[model samples]
Target: MNDDLRRAVRQVLPGVRTDLDALVRIPSVSAAPGSVEQVRRSAEMTARLFKDAGAPDVEILDDIEDGLPAVLARYPAPPGQPTVLLYAHHDVQPAGSPGQWSSPPFEPTERDGRLYGRGAADDKAGIAAHLAALRAYSGRPPVGVTVLVEGEEEIGSPNLGTFLARHKDKLDADVIVLADADNLTTGTPCLTTALRGMAACVVELRALEGGVHSGSYGGGVPDALTALCRLLATLHDEQGNVAVEGLATAVPPGAPVSEAGFRAEAGLLEGVQLLGSGSIAERIWAKPAATVLGIDAPPVATASPTLTPVARAKVGLRVAPGDDALKARKALAGHLRHHTPWGLQVTVVEAEVAQPFVIDARGPAFDAARRAYGEAYGNDVVDIGSGGSIPFVAEFADAYPQAAILIASAGADADSRAHGADESLNLADFERACLAETLLLAELTRSG
Candidate 1:
């Protein structure tokens, strides 16, 4: 059956490739204003693919309030078989600057076997892989398939949890497959079981009320920019760990990262020793990491030569699992407010808080996925965790607690440059993922 499924998927690769190209050509960036038309078009394309793959109810479900469209597709299960819900996003992050791309960001260009575009790696390819797997099995897939391709994931999936809560029964499934992730590295089949929580805060520091002449008040007046620099500097101690008080930390249970592997994949230069680590996995996945994202000050090239009155910075706190994002933000904010030098006033506005995700992997669905991946990749499988937080993961967990969740990402590599320029996914990896999904469905139906 696995071999037959593989052959079928191989046969369907050309169609998958064409569909992926067409989807990528649509500028489906949901976060940008005036991008609704493109997002709707992408959702329509996904629905068409679902219909082509034999989904019974492949409809573009649009939110009247949000105006974003989601593809809700369903295929009936044979008697005594269970339903599987496949979740992925049709929306993608904004393609920042065209100058940064090797080719036009919207144009799907294949170079050296890699397909490159804004949404190619992040999610659209995952959707294509799901379509390919479903097409291979003529959409029956040995188990019922209900797919929810969201259009607002890049903007934090604000409506997903609400939608899930409202339509719980409609989305009931025995297993849920989330394809927004990738492997631990090339050639490894990884199941991500944990995700670090995230907290975002914008810290604004003020001093001396307003800007003054640099030469006249340089030494006398307190410069807001200097105060901000000092405050941001204190976010991390000398060893480069977040110094915020009351931030909860935990050690995630999983495979530890090797030094050689980290060094090679992270591209760490010489003389730059990686900071604050027991293990790379611990530092990234379990421990808290703080970053000062953006500071609202003049550019170095456009210096005003004045003592700035206000300096604002956006700070990001990557918290470990089970850590409360709201608590972390409060703690960091309190620390900043109290630690401001010389009575400088500091205001920290809460930007966003996303709770972490941890999936229990001891279940029949996971066992089936392990078997499917092993068969597809011809390798042993490893369970891993991520430091990045997906805001909707916890919501999915809550909405589908009975459903076994599986994370089979195509670019789950440590060096997979997601959210960065030059991000690419291997075509072979994509094919393997599709075959694995097909096998997983077969295994799940057999389990019943």
Candidate 2:
């Protein structure tokens, strides 16, 4: 079986590059118009690969509502074997301002052993990895397999929770292979065990009726922009810690981010002091992170604004895995509403919220992943937590409590630029992930 799988994988290896490049060329940006049709085409292409790999039933379900089409394929369980739900997304983030790219963002190119193109790394490569894994099993994997390829994960998976809830029984599995994350660093297999929850709100304050002459009304009329700025200012203390009274929480011990790594990843300038005191892991995973995403005001180019009547700022709050998004949103809204310096009325618009996810570390699934990665890489898997939230992971965990959810992704290479102008993935790392997936499936089959 191993030899057969190996040969099948090798046969598919040369085509992986071709498949990824072909898909990347489609410009399937889910957020843009005419992109949904491209996304649907990609789904159809993906479904065909699964059918060729050995799936017995493959179907594409279009929007029962406002959702990108989801592709599901089922491979029945071999006697006494366990099923693995393979999850991936087909849609890609808009390749913002393609002019910023070294090459055309849609043209997959290889430089210094890295494939570069929009969606090449962020997730198209992930989709390729899933196809490669299925090819390795030759469609008749040792374990049962069902794939849930979502089309709108980049937009926070607004419709997936409902889809999962409706199809919960059909999707039950012993393990969930969420092939959407990356290793901690290149070649170092990373096992993501936790993700921070996220919630966003825009605080708008209106003090005056409309813009008034700055010189004339500067003293008598309260500046709405000033009041909004003050309200935003109160959100963080002098040292940059979130001063929102009830939002912050304690961080866990694992998933440490060294100061050096943080600086490098965040592109911190020299001589700049790092704000907030705590372990990098704690600061990112277990604690709350607040950011004033954007301010709504006249641009500097359009100067000479009279006393502005209204000003608003979009705020993003990242809560710990245990922090409640709704409660946090309410607390933040109330704080802003109560803390306005002047008598300006405040309006807070709740943008979006996603519950955090914490994978239980002590489980057979974790052990199998550790061992599979160890066998493939000759090293222990590193534990890490993501600051960004993938809501579907939380929803999946909620729906299938018994399943061991594992994220084996190839995202660590700097060359694997996801969401950037030119994104790519390491061919070697992708192959390693495919091998690991194969081993994991075999391990799960034997474990039961």
Candidate 3:
């Protein structure tokens, strides 16, 4: 069985690369300004790919108001066979600067056996993996299959709950395979078992009614930007741990991560000290981390000697695995309010907060996945926690508590630099992932 599936995946490699490259060529940055048309084009292209692969006719569902389109198609289950839902997203993050990339961010390039592009590893590769797995059996798997390719995962998938609620009958399955995580290393497979939740907010500080000349009021008065900076400083202590009091922390169970390996994978500059205490994995995967994503302030080029009246900053928080995202968001907001510098008037515009989740991965579904990935990679699978958050996973679990949810990476690793310039996918692991999924389908059908 394994040999046949390997040969099937090997035969499909050329077409897989061809389609993966084609998908990577589209600049489908869902959050970028003026990207509606590009996102639509991506959804259309994804639908066509699945339809051409011999699945049932696909549908591009965009009925939700003010929401991006998502493509979905399903193959009915045969008698006494369990159904599986394969999930991935088509959206990519905005490319910051073309000069920062070795190749054009939108143009796929292959070097050193890696495919380079914006969405190549982050999620476009995931879509390609699903296509390859279905095409491995010529789109008629032994078990029932449902493919749902969403378009807004990069923006935290705000509309996914709505979609899930509306499409329950079409999406429910015995098992869910979410291929949007990261492996431990190149050629090393990781079965993600937990994820830190996510939260965000924008805080605005107002110091004065209007701007004033620095020469006239610099020493005696304060600028809102400076006051905002001071207030933001209170969010962290001297050791760089999050200062929010209500947020909870945990000690995640995983293989210890050496500081040297962490430094190399993170691309830290020479002499930059690591933050906070315990092991590297515990600090990142088990603790709440806060960051200022962007500031709505005067540009450096446009700065002048003036006491700015107002300043706003966006705060992104990765909630720890054991904490509540809503409570953490309130804690952050409370800290900002109480720590307001110089009694400055502050307004915290709270954003979405997705609660952290721990998947129940100890049953037959997981056992089958482990055997499949181990056989495909010729190595034992390691379990890891994602420092990043996927709200949709938690939502799917909530919607169907009895279903088994398995999170695995399509091909991303620490070096992929997802959401950063020069993002790339390891092609060898990509093929292995396709083979693993194809084998998993057979495992499910055979065991049942």
Model number with the top lDDT: 3
Higher-scoring candidate on TM-score, 1 or 3: 3
lDDT of each candidate versus the true structure: 0.82, 0.79, 0.90
**Model 2 accuracy (lDDT, Cα):** 0.79
For TM-score, the strongest prediction is 3
Q: Which lDDT value does model 2 have at 327?
A: 85
Model 3 clash pairs are none
TM for candidate 1 is 0.95
Of candidate 2, the 10-residue stretch with the lowest lDDT total is 408-417
Winner by TM-score between candidate 2 and candidate 1 = 1
What are the per-residue Cα lDDT tens digits for candidate 1 across 1-448? 7778889989998998899889888989888888888998899889998998888887787745775888889988888889998888899888887898888888888787677888888888779878988999876678888998888888777777677766777789888888888687677788888888888888888787678899998888889899988888888878888889898878676777888888877778987878785788888888888988788997899888899888899988887887888888788888888788867878878887788877889878888888888988888888888888777678878776787888777543555566766566677788788888888888887676
Model 1 regions more than 4 Å off: 267-270
lDDT of 2 at 132: 81
Q: lDDT tens digits, residues 1-448, model 3?
A: 7898899999998998999999999999999869999999999999999999988858999989989999998888888999999999999999899999999999999999899999999899899999988999998988999999999999888899999999998898999999999888878788888799988889999989999999999999989999988988887888888888998997685756778988998999999988787888888889999999889988999899999999999998999987889889988888888888888889998997898988767888999999899888888888888899988888999998888998998988888999999999988888889888999999887666
Off by over 4 Å in 2: 1-7, 248-250, 253-255, 413-417
What's the CA RMSD for each of the models?
Answer: 1.8, 2.0, 1.1
